[model samples]
Target: MSDGPTDLPAPREAPDAGPYWQAAREDRLVMQNCYGCGTYRFFPSLLCPECGSEEQVWGPCSGRGTIYSLTTVHRAPSPAFRKIVPYTVALIELEEGPRMMTNIVGEGRNEAAIGDAVEVCFEARGTDAKVPQFKLAGA
Candidate 1:
């Protein structure tokens, strides 16, 4: 099984982050795209970092990336995460040119290698929670 808490703590949403999270709930991966500069930025913001434009748009992600960096957790950040010891925290370099931290999951969870190809897959929680997580490509 992919390592991590069975039920992740509910996400805390900020005003600027609403669209991103809403897209996730719909099982869609999106990034803040700068129309002026044609660059994508993460940790969503109203203004584009590259072009200083407030006219940014949410663009769909191919849900594809490469493992830029990673760590395998043998310990938990909190007692509630203890059950997920040995989970992976990775810096995924998305095809759109932004890197974000996310967990690596799937049958190859324990065998992730740097530079491994991955595709985004949604992890549904109960009824309304759908989180985009990375799995080995084609898994």
Candidate 2:
């Protein structure tokens, strides 16, 4: 019914995610780029995945991608997501080039397909709380 720790939300971002959030607040999808290896990264980390470099910078993304894979959750530990049973969560491969796992909102759960093109959208839960999500491309 649950994949991991549904009792808690995904790990909260460290203060280092500030720039990424700032870009999101402006409707921009920003990822991290390693200065040492020139690789695009996501989820905000201080080190490069390709290399062990600690120098990174924010990079803008195209907000276009295809669903690399997905899963529909039948149950949610939190009552808030109870009404959203069967919601699809996907791993998107961005055209600007990085894969980020996020929920696919505002679309029929059965509509998500592997390799289906999608676009970025933001769901703001509160005045200061927002999350990046995906939807059927051009939908």
Candidate 3:
């Protein structure tokens, strides 16, 4: 199964996701920080869910988290994922308190477990291509 160096799907460029996408393209993980609510939000939203505030800033992430939940897809749901059968998808709880959906890569992808410590790494498929993925920390 292949989860790297392939024609992965291109991400949608929504207005609020501009900064996030730009950071990912450079192999950097970032999140929105709501100063009004003193909390962070993942997946990039224009409005803060904590206190319904729209004022925020882009903050860098440690890219370290624990696997809060996970699932292994033995059967590819779409053609883009066919080559990566048995891949692990995880809900990573970032150090900053926000959770995100992402894939586990490298050898860890095959053996990811709940509570496993992971660190973010970029998987670039081609020239000017980059996506954030994770691997078992110190594995």
Error of 1 at 81 (Å): 1.3
lDDT of 3 by residue, 51-119 (tens): 999999999999999999999888887887887676788999989999988888877567789999999
Question: How does model 2 score by TM-score?
Answer: 0.84
Better by TM-score, candidate 3 or 2: 3
- For 1-139, candidate 2 gives per-residue lDDT tens digits of 2232233233354698987777766778888889898889876777987897998878888889999999888887677677567677789999867899988766553777998899998766444655677888877
The residue ranges of model 2 lying beyond 4 angstroms of the native Cα positions read: 1-11, 107-109
The deviation in Å at residue 96 for candidate 1 is 0.5
- Please provide, for model 1 over 41-131, each residue's C-alpha lDDT reduced to its tens digit, 9 standing for 90 to 100: 9978878888898877899989899999999988787874576677898999999999988888988877898999999977765446666
Residue pairs in candidate 1 whose N, alpha carbon or C atoms collide under 3 angstroms: none
What do the candidate models score in CA lDDT, each in turn? 0.82, 0.76, 0.83
User: Which 10 successive residues of model 3 have the least lDDT summed?
Assistant: 1-10
Off by over 4 Å in 1: 1-5, 125-127
The positional error of residue 18 in candidate 2, measured at the CA in angstroms, is 0.7
- RMSD (Å) of each candidate, 1 decimal: 2.0, 4.9, 1.7
RMSD of 3: 1.7
Question: TM-score for every candidate vs. truth?
Answer: 0.91, 0.84, 0.90
